[model samples]
Target: MKFSITTLSALLLVSAASVAQADSYADAIKSWCGGLAVTAPKTSTVVVAGAKTKITVTRKADERTKTITGLDLYSVSKDGKAKYVQNVWKGNYALKSSATISDAVPKNVPAGLYYYRVWVTNLIGKQHGPDCLETSRTFKVTTGSHTNAAGDLEYTESLHDNSIYNPEHEVGCFGLSVDYPKAGDTFKLNQHIHIQANRDAASQTDALTKVELYKGDQLINTAWTGSESFQNSFSLKDHLVLDNADTTSDYHYKIHATSKKADKTCVFKSGDFKISN
Candidate 1:
């Protein structure tokens, strides 16, 4: 069908106006969303294990109908890899001007490197909008063994001496803790001992290259390999059986790990244990 020139011109004007209206609406939505700002616990702050810490952040959105959803912690490796540790707080609270969230570092969280991030859910009309995230700077977690005059644990920043801080290495074990066979514990011969190590919040890119059992200077057996190793918890009971032949001396285990991104290998050793016939 043929259309008059005036009719076609009117249609074009209407289409152009529609496009401009849509663009304006998009810009308005973008402006409605807010940017989160973290002001406290500055970068490179040292946090003690088993201690309480506070985070302060402000929402800068034009809309004030936002809810603080979560405050989460993450473990960061030297190779710039991050893994979620735990949720310090998870709830819905109407945010006014700013808020201070408090959470204690888990006592069992091994001394390592970590950081915190805040999650906020914005309210668009009556529905919840997408979650917004603002990550804080990296922090250090110390063992917190020493105390000052007030009995508060004294925290001193550690030097970068290990693989975790080494520039040449891309991967390293953060908090390698043995779960079984405490030091000085004795196990009966022919007993099945479950050997396990917890690689606390290590990066997913890192893999266990070697897990070996040792007695003195001699190597006993390779417990697990990176190709078949567990990600967070390394356990190998089927390959580790205490026999009469293993009762000659004190025993220990070693773990070696590597990341695909680096050439350096991370090593960890367990305390001495014993086996008796």
Candidate 2:
């Protein structure tokens, strides 16, 4: 899945006259502007079946104070089909709030290419404006679980259509990446394996709470932990020793991160490789 940030920004900048010309739910949401800005995911995301995925709606206000009154989610398929998923929230919610909201992808949603959009209604001094925003890129829902060489469950993300294993940049509020052990690189037993996690720079008011490393389902190490603010790019590193692994099996490293700004925890898995005896 991929998100086009430029396209979304262009949609938000549509003139009121153009917005008025359309009569769709999306157009209606785009028509009103009371100085409330909504930011969605900046990159493609992937979630497994039956797993809870978070969708965070970040709001910025202008001179007028705005209160979020309602929130809804819609799913869009590859064939341009749109369906209402559910009402995420209703009633008055505060602005500039760091509260994280989340919902699970319907267990029945088949494995395929799809994207979600969030519609928000806000009140600015009795005036109501409903604005719509979508995930910058499409996301994937996989029915199969990913496992490592040890046959343990592993964290995973959708690869680009071209099958390239690149780190997700700016998922919701912050970006995550693995710098070392480029996907599919093999190593020898007893060789010191160093893993690195990088968080891209962001302009949101949020903090990264944790960065952890995993080998299959086993917790290898906790790289960093704290309420670290996201202002600049930073990296965390950890060393691993595979003493009990067999050379015939495939292996991979998975990075997990938690951020208050995101509705769901960020996860990215490395490409499969092996340990040569």
Candidate 3:
């Protein structure tokens, strides 16, 4: 999903009903949401379904009126334009306060800063709440993140590249690990980037020569010419993103690796996985 970056301050939430009541809404967020922690996908870079995200909202009685409509995600760049990020999870609009929403990464989401806006929406646009009572959480997506794994090659998401494969800039630049994600662990696609062929693939001196993520036969995503290296520690923050997978299926990733002489294409499958929203 296309996205921008922004910091959310005092949230003035208005419901789908355009009536901003001048009444004191209790601190339902802390009351019902106290001690609530989300089981975030490891490494932040995750696949759409592989994203291990879970929220533990406390069960409270006063949190009756507050409604959690949509669980939004984004790819931010430290700017104020944090609204364009794609939404992976959209909670039930009329659900009560004690409701807990969960969803994997969205299929069509691009790379950028992501946030979760707890508010209502009408036919027009997003409804603003009376105060910033709506809870907002923020995260970023350079390559992406999710939880669990299937076999190993679960190419769930992918994006395009501009360099290596010009005939199809779509498949040349970036690759996603899984097109069909699993139930456990976190999976994510690389960002939209250009592939870089290395003069040498060893010595732990050069950056990533080539990066490609894929599904079974379908190419999920591909990217090259990264700015960092994964020789000792593989960092997903330096790659682009690509996502196109189901959150509940068992899947893995086939990271295509290339060196000076031999080109290594690694395929990873998953074990037993699941996805529920």
Candidate 4:
């Protein structure tokens, strides 16, 4: 969905000078044509996949405004490039108006942070102002069901229930276990913590790249097979010990894993397990 420079220039009345003239591209577009203002989702909107997003846009095509013949919606890329994701609205003749664009986020869209912008196209089908309102013009996608091949993570204190700990009763590297940590499951400081990454039965070929424990954004510990991938299932049995000076706060530990079969490099996080002294 990458737009060509020529097409973009023609659509957005952006001159090479405007791009080079200002350090901030958005500011340059604003200077060029005052910019079309997007007035919905004042904050960073969370767009769950397969859901409808109601977007409201307004543009004034007067002497003070740039001629807006058409309106386009684009998702901004990591490299600060705009990729046309959807055409929210269009006009055969340029006029001043306001419209609400209801766009359905694709069910299979990748889970990550996304930013969208409205591009105003001129009478000749040339696009103008790449108006991305404000610095916080972004949205988020939580989980894509299609990419979530790994099952939910599990935890148990009983070795009998989790045969992976019992050498004689072990089934493969890890055994079939249940009694995963519930929403209110909490662990004591310095207690034996056992969590298992339930490999998707359908994704037996996918390699378990790594398993990590995190407290908020800080990494607590990690376990990964050296150069090889864990064949099917993996288990992490470690003592839950908070830093000596961090006794006052009850922190929640998060488990994340990377799967080769899912082709996802970004770690997929599971539910949080509370920890306390």
Instruction: Report RMSD (Å) for each prediction in the order shown.
Output: 19.6, 17.1, 22.2, 21.3
Q: Against the unseen true structure, what C-alpha lDDT does each candidate score?
A: 0.62, 0.49, 0.34, 0.43
> What would the TM-score be for candidate 4 when compared with the true structure?
0.32
What's the distance in Å from true for residue 256, model 2? 39
Error of model 2, residue 170, in angstroms: 15
Candidate 3 is scored at a TM of: 0.28
lDDT of 2 by residue, 1-277 (tens): 1114553355456644544443354345444442333343324566776777665555444544444555554444332233456665676656554334566767776655444444444556866655433332445666657778999775444444423222222234224455666767788654556555454322222345665545566665565566544333334333334456666665666655554335655565556667787
Per-residue accuracy of model 1 over 1-277 as CA lDDT, tens digit each: 1224564466567667755765565454455444566665654466778888778887664644777788888876554456788988889877767888887888877666666777777776787665666666455677665777999765553535454433322233344556665688776654556667675543422456777878987887776564433336655552335444566588887777664333657666677888776
Residues 1-277 of candidate 4 have per-residue lDDT tens digits of 1234554466346444643443364345456545356566433465666777765656655544333334444443332223455654555433366656566776765544343344454332354444223211345544432323476432222223322122211111211121244445677866656556554322212234555566667776663333323323444455554465244333333433333213334333545567766
Shift in Å, residue 150, candidate 1 = 14
Candidates 1 and 3 compared by TM-score, better number? 1
> What's each prediction's clash count?
0, 4, 97, 8
Model 4 steric clash total: 8
Best by TM-score: 1
Candidate 3 global lDDT: 0.34
- Rank order by TM-score, top first? 1, 2, 4, 3
lDDT of 3 by residue, 1-277 (tens): 1111221111113221321221122233234343332224322333443354553233233323444555545333322222334555555544333455665655455554344444432221353333221322233333443354664443323322212112111111112222222435454433322222221111112234344444444555443333433322332222323344465454333334332112333222223332222
